[model samples]
Target: MRKLRELFRLRFEAKLTTRSIAASLGIGNGTVCDYLGRARVAKLTWPLPAELDDDAALTALLFPEDAKAQAERPEPDWARVHAELKKKGVTKLLLWQEYLEAVPGGYQYSRFCERYGRWLATSSVTLRQEHRAGEKCFVDFSGDGVRVVDAVTGEVRVAKLFVAVLGASNLTYVEPVFSEDVATWVGCHVRAFEYFGGVSEVVVPDNLKAGVTRAHRYEPDLNPTYADLARHYGFAILPARPRRC
Candidate 1:
């Protein structure tokens, strides 16, 4: 369409008849007439803009310019934050808070997160790697069932067992429990940490009823006992999403 219009314009400027222009451009005579009609309606003159030498540039100039640029946040000192996160216990939220304090008129929470995510795209980091010794402890429920037996009454009960796997060593600890209640859930973590000999820097768990009271995709609510256990161990509890199950 654009090429036909340009060809008609050039031929008409050279004072050729509509039929002649159509023949030269290998288009229908009616197409040449339509182009001439459109040019007349648009009030396009023979002489075009000096800057618009080509058809592409002329077409661009016909349309209105885009809107002005929007305000944006400044880039953060990613190197410092990256180093800090590598240290024992550093969180993105904590770093963001500190950034706000240091730069009074800095980026908002959402923008800060957006910028951090962009940085992560080009980051030379491993998504999944062997954790250093005593680095992380991952806890979750076992898919298979475990049986709990009573010696005196000769009673047997099948229940779900909570399992904890160390990130570095792959050393796992399992405990059979009657229910997935809050008390049992919190108690299992305590025993698991003790069994590991020392508390880990981070604790990862699924969004189970016992651990998380409200399971939100963006922000989750950790049960009081769950938070308390984290404080006791000087670690953090990052709940995994339900989709992970």
Candidate 2:
């Protein structure tokens, strides 16, 4: 009731438009009009205080025609359920059946499975660490490269050279360079990072000449500029070990 009175006051005494007031209050203009209509019908006076606007009274006035109250759903106990599922090869279907049996009215099988999947995704840690927002980036050259012919010199150069992809958003940054020298590689990394709007925690690269000095089966030495770039970006580099197919 008091909110309606305030809305009315703002409309009449303060001389503010309904749309402006609604925007300020983060509600629709039609909502403000509805409140004003209700206030006028209830024969409300102006200058009503905030304490007089009880939510129950406002709800009764706003929705006098409706009888059914909104349903309040119970919160699920995920910790206990996760603990139960972690033991002895228990499956989600079995847990869902248990949930249906335990609770008087619980989620149906489909909804139960969906909710459980979401819960497992948030709770469990898999082999590959989950990529957080703006955390790490991966850079690699595509296996295939496109060629372009120079019109004047009649020399052929690869048009598509290197492709850098952010691990989190899958945003690609591409550049064409003559060769994968240390300078070109470092410059590419700098341009890619600038394009991404921020630096990533780590850069995962394959054993390439520009970045990796000595590609061993276990430990690989990073090129000097690559290390300097890592220092500039406050990130670490992990080169993939050589594999014989």
Candidate 3:
């Protein structure tokens, strides 16, 4: 549901192309189009209604067919459940069983997890920091990919998404590449820098295999090609700490 809201934000506020949005979110282009189509049919716009903030509410409004079934089931206090999961030795399966014990007709384990995930997504928040212009650029790849098929041979391949964001402005650049090889990674960075019209002093990237051969807290090993790219661009490569989250 976070992706759903971001889909609306990317389309209405950022004004990115549908394909770009699909790539950035690592969803299919058809999926992006379908979401937009549903939004149009529902007459939903950016800064969605306060009443529609919850995933269940948004889902009910967007896909009304399942509303009755969903409403019939008793829902757990998701806020409390979310907080509890943070404690040691607590898991979703245990929580779901407890919920069922309390409410005999409540959602099953699968449904419980599904609802919890949706709620988690909608309730998630991101912290932003202020930085001097051109000071830092953060980059990462989406977890999924978009499919691309050959025109004549009909060979299908997955295109990875490369996303770069400026620290100060939160300005973003996204591109789809056939692979995450060192060359492709470096090329994407160059293009992103060009898109921003300048290079940042530091490039902070997630510990991607192509860019960082080995991730470390104090010092990370950069791929030779990636290192050369940094040298040529005169920007420092700062790989994000491994497993910090």
Number of the predicted model whose TM-score against the real structure is largest: 3
lDDT of 1 at 159: 88
Worst-scoring 10-residue span by lDDT in model 1: 63-72
Q: Per-residue CA lDDT of candidate 3, range 89-148, in tens?
A: 799999888998999988878888977865664454333345898899999887577899
Q: What is the TM-score of each predicted model, taking all chains together?
A: 0.45, 0.45, 0.52
User: In lDDT terms, which candidate is top?
Assistant: 3
lDDT digits (tens) for residues 3-22 of candidate 2: 44455667778989989766
Backbone clashes in model 1, listed as residue pairs: none
Question: In candidate 2, where is summed lDDT lowest over 10 consecutive residues?
Answer: 66-75
Error of 1 at 88 (Å): 38
RMSD of each: 23.4, 16.2, 12.5
* Backbone clashes under 3 angstroms, per model: 0, 0, 0
User: CA lDDT of each candidate?
Assistant: 0.72, 0.70, 0.84
* Alpha carbon deviation, residue 68, candidate 1 (Å): 67
Question: In angstroms, how far off is 43's CA in candidate 3?
Answer: 39
Give the runs in model 3 whose Cα sits over 4 Å from its true position: 1-73, 77-128
